[model samples]
Target chain A: MHDSAQDDVTTMTFEAFADTILPGEKRFPGDVTVAGVAVGGGAVASGAVAVLRTDEGGMAPALDNLAEALNGHAGGYAAERGLSLDPAVPPFVALSFADRTELVARLTAPTHPERDIWVSVAMFSTIAFDAAAHLHTVDALADGHPGMTTMGFKPPEADGLWRFPEFSYGRQLARPHPDTTPSGSPA
Target chain B: MTAIESTDVVVVGSGFGGAITAYHLAAGGARVVVLERGPWLTGQDFDQDFKFGSSSTRAFDFTIGDGMSVLAGNCVGGGSVVYFAAMPRAPRFVFERHGSIGRRMWPAAISRDTLEPWYDRVAEALPVTRQDWSDVPYAGGLWAAACHHAGRTANPVPVAIDNERCVNCNWMMSGCRFDAKRSLLLNYLPAAIAHGARIRPLHEAQRLERSDDGGYRLHYTVVDDVDYRVEVGGGAIDAKVVVLAAGAGATPVILQRSADTLGPMPAAVGRYFSGNGERLNTAVIDEDRVREVLGLSRSDGVPYEAYQIGKGPCVATWDRLDGSLPEYLRYSLEQLYFPPGFGTILAQVPDATGPTWFGAEKKELLRHWKSWLTIFTMSEDDNEGVFGPPPPTGNAVRVSQQMLGRGALRYRPTENTLRGWAASDAEVRDILERDGLARVMPWTNDVVGAYTVHPLASCRIGDDPATSALDDRHELRGHPGIFVTDGSAVPGALTVNPAMTIAALAERAVPAIVEAARQRGVAVRYGAPAPDGATAARDAVLPLVAGRAGR
Candidate 1:
C-alpha cells in the first residue's frame, strides 16, 4: 500500500495524464491535480480516477507504479531536452500541457516496448470520457454525464425503451412481411 | 472426483452449432447433454455497456493472439446471443475458390448447391428476414446513399431479428436487452430443452478420452457463474458420442490436449485459420453534406443535423460481391453502429493538421459522433492462419487451460488480402470523398494488428486427413464417434458472417451423426419433424435460391 502523500501524488499524476488526453477545466478552486487547460468537462471531470479505481478497470492495483513510471519517464524527457522542472508537485503533473502531450506520444509510439500499457491507460481514459465504463448506463444518463451529453446520445423514453416510428430514409424501401404482427414479431 | 454422469451424446458448446445439433438429436430421441463453458443469461441480465473484463457471461470474450485479436461470445446461446444477426449465405465462389497452394480450400462435396437445403433449415429455425427499407437505420440509409453515389447498390442484409420488437437501440452486439433479436436462446435452445436435452451451463470441457465401453469420456470443470473461477476436482461424463462445437479458437485447443490420452490428433487439427478478411473503418460526413444527402430544403426551417448512427440495427451491408470486381477485390461493406459509450472509445479519427487522438480536434469529432459512419468490411482471403502453442514470449491468451500455453494464432494477411483491403479502402474513400467528408479512418493498423469477430476454419473439414482435422462427414479423422461441427469445421472463409454457414454445416452433418449413434445402439431416431414456427420462418426467407438472391 502507498502512503497518503504518495497516493495523493499518484492521483494528481493520473489526473494530469487524463486531462492531457481530454483536457478540461479545474473541478474546484485550489485543485492543483487537474490542469485547467480546456473549456469543457474532459476525462478528469468525467471521473477518470474513479473509473480507473473500478475492479473492472483492472488498473487499480498498478496505479502507483504507473505514476512512478510516468514521473521517471518525465524526468528523463526533461533531462534530454535540458529543460528545468518544477520542484512542486510530481514530475508529470509539473510539465506543461504541450510537454505532457509530447511525452505521451513518445510513450505510445509504435516501437515502444511498453506501448501496450500506455495505450491501455489512454484507452481507459478515453473510455471514461466516452462510455462512462464505470457507471450504469441508465444512471449515468439520468445524471447527465458530460461525455454522453456532448455526444448527443438519445435517451430512453419514459417507459425506459427506445421506439423510433420515424423512418430514417424518409421513405420506405420495402413492405413488412405479411406475417409480422402489430407488435413487430412474426406471427 | 465427482461420480461420472452418463449421456447418449454430449455436445460441447451452446452456440448455433451445438444448440442446433442438440435440438435435432434430442428430437430424434437421443439423450443429449450440452455442456456450455459460459453462463446461461437472459435479456434481464443484458447490458449495453462495453464489458472487457473476464466474466463468465460477458456478452463477448476477446482473445488476443500473436497477430490478431479474436472476439467470441461467452454465454449459453454462444455467438448467436451476441452477433448482429446478419445471416447472409456464402457465395458459390467461396466454396470453389482455390488457395495459393493450387488446391481447393473447401472439399468438392461442399458448395452453395449442397448447403442450400441446410441453409434453408437454419433460416427457418432462426426465422431469417430481410430488413424493410423503413427499418433501415439512419447510418444504413447514409451508407446506401453513399453506395448509390459510387454507382453501386446497397441492400438490406438478411438477418435473424424480429423487425417489430427492435427499437433501433443499437445494442445488438452487446446482447439485446429487449429479447428482440432471434438468438438461439429464443429458438433452438428452448426447443432442445423441450425435447429433454439437458443444458449444463458453466461446465468447461477440458479433455476427451475413450471410455471403457467403447464410448467417449469428457473431462470438464464446473466454474462459478459470476467470476468464472474454477472449482476443485471438476467432473467427467461418459457418452456414446461427443460433438465438439466449442468454436474455432476453443475446439482446437481441446483436441490438442486430448492428444496425450486419445492418441495424437491429425496434423491438420489446428491449421487453416481465417479471420474472413474482417476490417473496421469509419467515415465522418460533413454536416452540410449530410443535409444535402437527406434532401433538406432551406425553407423547411429545421436546422441541419447529422443522423444518429446508434438508432438502428448493427449492420446493413453494401454488397460489392458482384462478378464485375475481381475475386480478390470483391468485398462487402456493412454499415455499423456502436452505442454512444462504445462509439466514443472508437473516436480516434486521424487528422493531418492535429493530434489524432487528443486535443480540441478530437473533442470536436466527439461532438459530431452521430455523424460518423462505421464500415465493417469482409472479403475472401486465404485460410493460411494457423493456431498452435504460444511462443516462449509475447502476449497471447490461453483460450483453454489444456492448451499448455496460450492458444496462439499465427496469421499475417496474404498479399491478396492486403490488395483486397486496399481496394476496399480506396472504394470507400472515393465514395465518401465524392459526397464530402471530414476524415476516413480505419480502426486496424500496425500497432493494433487485425481484429476479427468471425474466426473460422481453425480445424477445417475436408476429404483428406492430411489437410483437414475432420472428414467431409464432419467426423474427426480416425475418430469415428468424435465430430466437429462449429466454426472450426468450416473449411474456408465464407466471405460473409459465418454464423449461418456454421449452423448450416451442423444441420447437414446431424443426419450422419444420428446414424452413427444408432449403429452404436444409442436408440437414436432420424428425420425428426421441425419445431414450431420452423416452416414459417423458412418459407419467409427462402426463395429456392442460394446466397443473397433469396434475400
Candidate 2:
C-alpha cells in the first residue's frame, strides 16, 4: 500500500519541521551547528520519505508511533519524553510549526527510543533539500543554503562537447573479432 | 455468448519484446492488439526531477527470496522505456557459452545472423551510436582515463540516443525529457500504432483459458489507478494467437497462474533465471578536477547545475582482455551519472550505511557531487535461478496468485553466481586506483537490492519440452498458438544489454508466427519484409552496435 506519510506531512507543521532540521539561510557560514532558515514548504520532503518508506517499509509505522507519542496517549514514546502524564495537548496535526519541531527533536533525540524516526525522515529530507534547494539552480544554492555551489563547485556543461583525451584507449577496446569461444568449448 | 473483445493476435506486455512483436506482426498485416499494464507515457510526461519517475505503480519494484527488491519498468513501452539504452549485441562467446546447449539455443532458436538485420532495422529506426571523448560530460573523462591507466580498452557503448537532439540532461533513468533517447515509445510502438496496432495501456492480463472455438481467451483487468497499491477492475479479450512478453519476472507468473487450464509446463518453466551478474561500484574523484578539467568553474551568479546533463550515453565500456574465460563470463564496465541532487539521497552505498551517515557526512558527499562517478559491471550470469512461490511482497503477486496459483511467482538469484560478482567490483576499484582518478568507496555486498535491469531466461527455449519451456520456434511447446518471446526465452545472459537482441528475436519470431496464424485461417497481411530479416547476412556477428553499420 502507498504510505500516507506524505499526506500527513503536507501541512504547515511538516514544512516547519523540515526548516528546523535543515534551515537553508538560517545557519551562519562555517558554523554547522548554527540555525538556518526553514527548509520545507512544499510536500517534497515528506513525499520523498513516504516514497522511501513504501520501498523500504517500517518507517510508516514508526512515524505513526511517534505521532501518537506526541499526542501523549499511546506508546511510551511520549512517557519517555516526560509527556505521558501531561494533559493531552493538541493532536500532532494541530500543533504549531515550532511545537512540531520541538516534538520531533525530542522524539528523535539520541536518548529517545524512536531516534530511528529521525534517521529515515532526516536522510530523505536532506536529499529532498538538495534536489529542491540546490540542484535546480545556483540561486537556490546560495540563498543561505550550503550545497555544491557553496563549496565552489564548477559543474560541467552537459550540452557542449569537450575532448576526453582518452579517446584512443576507447577505440582500441572497440576493435573487431577473434572468433573466440567459451572456456568449455569442445575443440 | 462470448463476452470478450476479440482480435487476430493478442500480444501481452508492450515492452521491447511485446512492442517489437506488435510492430512486426502489425506490419505483417495481422489484426494486433497489445495489453500493457502501465500507462502510455510520452516524453512530455517524463520529468527531470528525481521524484518525477519514481511511480510505485508504473515502475514495478518487487522483492523476492532474501527480501531483496528487483525492479522492472511497467509502462507501455516496458523496460525499453526505463533502461540505460545500452545496446550491445550478444557476443559469439555468449551464444557459445553453455557448450552444446548454448550452441543449439543460440543459433538454432534465434540466430545472430537472423537478428543482425533486425538490429540494423532497429538502429535505423532509433538513434544508435557511440560517443567519443567530446560527446560526454566530465564524468566520461574519468572513465576513459581509468580504462587507459588499467591498460584496458574503453570502447564506446552504443546508446539509442540522437546526440544532435540530446541536451545530455542525463535523466534517462526517470525517462528522457528531451525525447532524445529512442525508447520503444518513439520507434517500435509508434511504428506499430501507425501500422494499425491497438495499444491498451492500463489493461493488465490476468488469466488465460482455451476458448471453445480453439482460440485463446484472456481475462484481464483495467487498472483504475496505480499509486502505492494497484487498483484494478476486471476485463477480458480473445485472440487466435497469444504472445506472452510480460517479462522474465512476470511472464512465468502469468503462465503459472494459468497452468491448470493450460496443463503442465516443462520442469524448467521458472528455472534458469539469471540476474546478468550485475554489480555497481562507485568512487569519488578530486572535486576541483571536475571544475578544472571540464571548464565548469564557478561564475559569479550562474546557477549550480547539480543535475547530470550531456552525460546521456554510458560513454565507455571496458572488456575483459584475457580470452581465457568464456565471452559470456567476461565482465564489461559501464559508467553511470546521476543528478547530484538525486545522488545525495539515492546513490548506492555500503549496506545499511545510508541512515547512519546523515546530516554532515551526507552534506559532505553532496558538496562534491560532480566528483562522484559510479561504474557498473554487467557480467553474464550462469543461468541458475527460479521465479515462483515468493512470500507475498506486492500486489503483482497477490493479484496474479489469486488468478493463477498461489506461491507461483518469485525470483531466486544464484548465490554462487552472485558471489562471482565480487571480482568485477574489485576489478573496477583496481582500475580507478591505477588511474589515480578517484578514491574507491567501500564495497557493499548488498546483492539483496541486487539490480536485475537485464533480467533474462526463466521460460527459456530449447529442442526438448522436458527440459525447456518453449521450442526452437519460440512456441510454448505443447501450446500451438501460444508463444513466449521476451527475455524469459533467452537460455543464458547475452553478456550485454539484451534489449536489441530481445527485439531482434521478436522480429525473427513474428514471421513464423504469422505463418502459423495463416495456417489457422487467420487473415494476416504480410507487410514489406523487415529491413534486416529479409536479407540474412552470412558474416560472423560483429562485437557491438558500432560494428554493425557505423557510428
Which is the leading candidate under TM-score?
A: 1
DockQ of each: 0.31, 0.11
Query: Could you give candidate 1's per-residue lDDT for residues B1-551 as a string of tens digits?
Result: 55789999999999988998899899878999999987788887776554334222265565656566677887799999878888877766677766544677677788877787787788777777766666676667667666665666566667888878886666677678888899998888999999999999878888889999999999888766544433544788999999999888788878877887899888888788888888777777776765676443222433223345343333333356654556677677777765543334444566636567665567777777766777777887777688776332211333222111233777788898888888877777777777564468777454345767888888888877678888888999878899899998987766667788999899888877887798788777655445664465345324432232112
Per-residue CA lDDT of model 2 for B1-551, tens digit only, reads 54688898999999978987788678767889999877777776765533323332244433323312345777788887777787766665555556224444553545554556656655555546655545555455556555655665565566777766666556576577667777888777887888899999877776688987898988877764433234466567889999999888777767766777878767777777776766666676654543444333323321222224344435445456233774444766777654433224434333333232333333444455555677766676666666654332222443221111123333444544554466676777787755244566532333223456677788887765655788877888778899888998887766566777777677556656776777767776444433333322212222222221121
lDDT of 1 at A21: 77
Task: Mark the regions of model 1 whose C-alpha exceeds 4 Å error after superposition.
Answer: A29-33, A170-187, B48-57, B229-233, B293-319, B340-347, B358-360, B388-407, B533-551
Chain A TM-score by candidate, in order: 0.85, 0.41
- Report lDDT (Cα) of residue B15, candidate 1: 97
lDDT of model 1 at position A28: 94
| Best candidate (score: DockQ) | 1
Report the error of model 1 at residue B93, Å: 1.2
